[model samples]
Target: MRLVNTFAAAALATGLASAAFAQDPTKVGFIYVGPVGDFGWTYEHDQGRLAVIEEFGDAVETTFVESVPEGADAERVLRQMAQSGHDLIFTTSFGYMNQTMNVAKQFPDVKFEHATGYQRADNVSTYSARFYEGRHVIGLIAGGMTESNIVGYIGSFPIPEVIRGINSAYLAAKSVNPDVQFKVVWSNTWFDPALEADAAKTLIEQGADVLMQHTDSTAPMTIAEEEGIIAFGQASDQSSFGPNAQMTAIMDDWAPYYVSRVQAVMDGTWESTDTWGGIDSGMVAFADFSDKIPADLAEQAKAAADAIAAGELHPFTGPINKQDGSPWLAEGETADDGTLLGMNFYVEGIEGVIPN
Candidate 1:
């Protein structure tokens, strides 16, 4: 009798599985590191999520959890989504690398996409934008406009992504003005508005006339506006936050990539791959130059943008040096994908260490 009952239970489970397969709505989920209302990195990614919903309509179902921490909570959230029958999941933060990997291992049948991570499994893929390209253009404008020759940088962490942006901005600034120096403050958190604002004020006190940031808030720009200094936006278009102070913005448009990934899943063609797109691919873009930027400088920035799009210029060209006065690249040489992938040191003109 017990064996018969066990067989009956197995049959019922199979029947439920078949019913769910028939009724499945192509579920996709996202996990965010910051509030969607931050109007920066998380906001841009959420915009992509919304685009997926609109593009797929009734054919797909989507949900997300915001303000997820990087460790155990992230693992729990991702596991819950997988157990709930989500077909695909996107973890949109650098810190989610290992958690995503672990979860992907557990749910081998489900697909996982992580941002800014190097690790990969058969079920896991990674994607990110070349944001520093946009930073180079705005750095030129900042260097041209600054009267003090000192630029303030608010950095979230010393990871390669943020470090790359800092070094790129410094290199571009020094290219236009040899006297320019960067003052950097490391907050160690991605979206702490209070810390970001404090860092901006401290840099201003240190005589920095221009501000740039790798953080995900409008607070630094707001402070710059109040103090009558100039700043650039990061991860999103933030001109509305500081019309007078914001010179230009680096905007991240993830909608196209999101739609393509979802369609691939629907077609059963999803595969693990790394995607790094810049201006030409429409993943990374620059907002219009603010009126605070001189007309000639804006023209120069636009020309650089066009050149990048046309493949006429490379940002990490040779004749570059490390902060320790060692040659990183020889003259007439450009950086290759391998070097940029593992960049961990500061370039010339940056003052601080790339914190661990």
Candidate 2:
């Protein structure tokens, strides 16, 4: 009877210990579109992941799979993360939108955040930074510094995000230098070094003295440096890759957002939300201008960036027209958020079809 009582008591103690140890650390997962060492888009996002690690040392555990392709592979990766007991997962690419949505339905308990996408669900959220604001500042610098009156732009896709950057850059450049023209080449990729380098060479051959890119690799920057032309960094600082060619960079700061979202999940306050943060919110920032840029031009760019952050100026405010000369924004009328989110056509003076 004593042995039986002791066994029951031990079993009760074991149950209590099991209950105590059942609270595991919150698990977070990240899916990257490119390698973390790309030193551009994926690099910036990996920094955010590191920030999450720093913020919550023992309370949270983070895992990442880099260079995960964006179709069926992405869906498989997301499902695997969910099955592994991940409390939160971030799909950091536009192509992962539908996949993210599909996975969210299966793992309704897991929180998912998709970057640069509009889709959302009860367990899914959307987030993006206003990179176009930074593009405008660089455009001004590119216009003032170009010697051949031509600025070459490298694009990843013809999506609204990339299109918005192109248009914003062109408008800012035109405002600064009336004779400046933009030569845009779509690489149809986010991170292909050979293709981006080839595009840069093609543009340089066609008389582009300044280079800009919406792609993620540093190939364009390297080409610009080798050719003695100035260029702007895409998602992160590429000055090391192009000491003299890098005039400035549009930095994506996702650390604060990532930490906050993770904390939200921990606090039981996480809800599906769409967050589009910009310069005003510190989501989009800039690297220091290169010494190659004239001091006056650098000052103007800084002042313009300040004006943008302070709401004193709007990049899309204007009398504008579509590619076919259709009236779009009237004089002094700023673009609405909805129109900008769905932007697909080039401005009146851009001189090209959107490549449906």
Candidate 3:
């Protein structure tokens, strides 16, 4: 009797699996690290999610958990989505890397995508934009507009991604205005508005006339407005938050990429691969310059952006050096993807060490 019951249970499970496989719509899920209302990282990613919905309509079912914490809660949420029969899941934060991998292991049939992460599995894929390209543009503007010659940068963490942005910004700024300097402060958390605001005020106090950030909050731009200083936006357009202070914004347009990925899944062509898109690919976009910048400067910034998009320039073009005054890149040379992906050192002339 026990053997007969075991066989019946196995048959029922197989039937259920077959029924699910015959379903028409694909189920996709997203996990976010910050509130969608933040109007920054999460908001841009949410735009992509909405695009997926608009593109697929009834052919796909989508769900998202916003403000999901990075560690244990992330793992739990991902596991639940996999168990709930989600065909694909996008974990949209670097901190969710391990959690995504762990959940992917437990559900071999489900596909997982991670943003700004390096790890991958047979079932996992990673993607990120070359935001350093936009950073370079903003740095050029900052270098041209700053009266104090001191530009401020508020970083979200000490990771390679943040470090690369800082280095790119500094290099661009220095190239344009040799006297320009950078003051960097790490908030250590991605979405802490209070910390971001505080960093902005501190940098301003330290004589920074222009502000930039890798954080996912509008607080820095808001502070820049109140202080009558200039600033740039990150991840999304933030001109509404600081109309007078915001010069330009570095936008991460995930809509195209999201639509493509979902289409691939629907067409049964989806595979785990690493995708690093940039200005040329339309992943990195820049907002229009504010009126605070001179017309010539704005035009120059636009020309630089166009050159970058046209592959006429690279942000890390050498005659560059490490922070310790050692030679890094020779003239007319550019950095490779491998070194840039794992960059951990500051470029020459940038002050301070990268916190671990």
Candidate 4:
């Protein structure tokens, strides 16, 4: 029964693609998890949306709805977009995974793309970035610069993606300074500035001298600046929020990928494929190092960044152990795709759960 449904879905997607090809001015739509003015995740995605419009000018038309919550409202908005004749839809949030899948089944004639998710169907594709790569670099700086040796991490969820970043950052920090320790606070919501600011204040009260956040807002950075501690930006270049407190930032560049996918649709070659890019691919990038960072530590971070981009170093190499003291990887070995994709445990140096 499952196989039959899969075949039918594939046939439907193919038919839709054929019809879209036979028409001019392909219609594309986007769904954002936050407001376009958030200056974080959604804002970066909207930049990519603009790039798509500029690239395909007369050949493509695009529309988007911002600040859509991730449950029934998301499904309703997606269905409405499809009903409005959007040939392709891009759902820009991990929480939209199952919602996208459900909507795709209902709108078999439309192609769907989800960001930072693993699930895929005949009409759905998943894409993400090696964001932890940037975290590793920032961790090194945090470890080297912290007089308190306490770093605070503001995370949104305990999922594999967020946990993998926490572990990678911890490993990098421990490698530089054995005394460095991490404090984590999970807020569960992605874009709540008030809640995120309160979490940052709590971490500051706990003696954290360097701050990092996985949540999608500038609140954490602003808090770091107000408290005179160092912080790193996420999803977008947020240094403007904390010029003195921001040591560096990870910027998400999605224009290239967006262009390629749209071109695939134009050329009749669109298919379900998972894309994960790192430093070398320009999908994941770091902002310029700030003068607040120690000159020597900045040099070290840049060297590591160069090595990773040149394919000479990997952030997740072993002999590594989990928090339970069980070996996770052997010496001279690096984590494979499957292991990284399913990562749900903290390394020995970390002191928290991977959160269910």
Q: Write the per-residue lDDT of candidate 3 for residues 274-307, one digit (tens) a residue.
A: 9999999999998878988899988888998999
Q: Mark the 10 consecutive residues where model 2 has the least summed lDDT.
A: 1-10
Per-residue lDDT of candidate 2, residues 134-204 (tens digit):
98899999889988999999988999999999999999999989999889999999999999999999999
TM-score of each: 0.93, 0.94, 0.93, 0.92
Candidate 3 regions exceeding 4 Å error are 1-22
Query: What pairs collide in candidate 2?
Result: none
Q: Please provide, for model 4 over 254-317, each residue's C-alpha lDDT reduced to its tens digit, 9 standing for 90 to 100.
A: 9999988989888889999999999999998998889978789899999998898998989998
Note the Cα lDDT for every prediction shown: 0.87, 0.89, 0.89, 0.88
Task: TM-score for candidate 4, please give it.
Answer: 0.92
Number of clashing pairs per prediction, in order: 0, 0, 0, 0
Clash total of candidate 2: 0
Better of 1 and 4 by TM-score: 1
In terms of lDDT, the poorest run of 10 residues in model 1 is 1-10
lDDT agreement of model 3 with the native = 0.89
Better of 2 and 4 by lDDT: 2
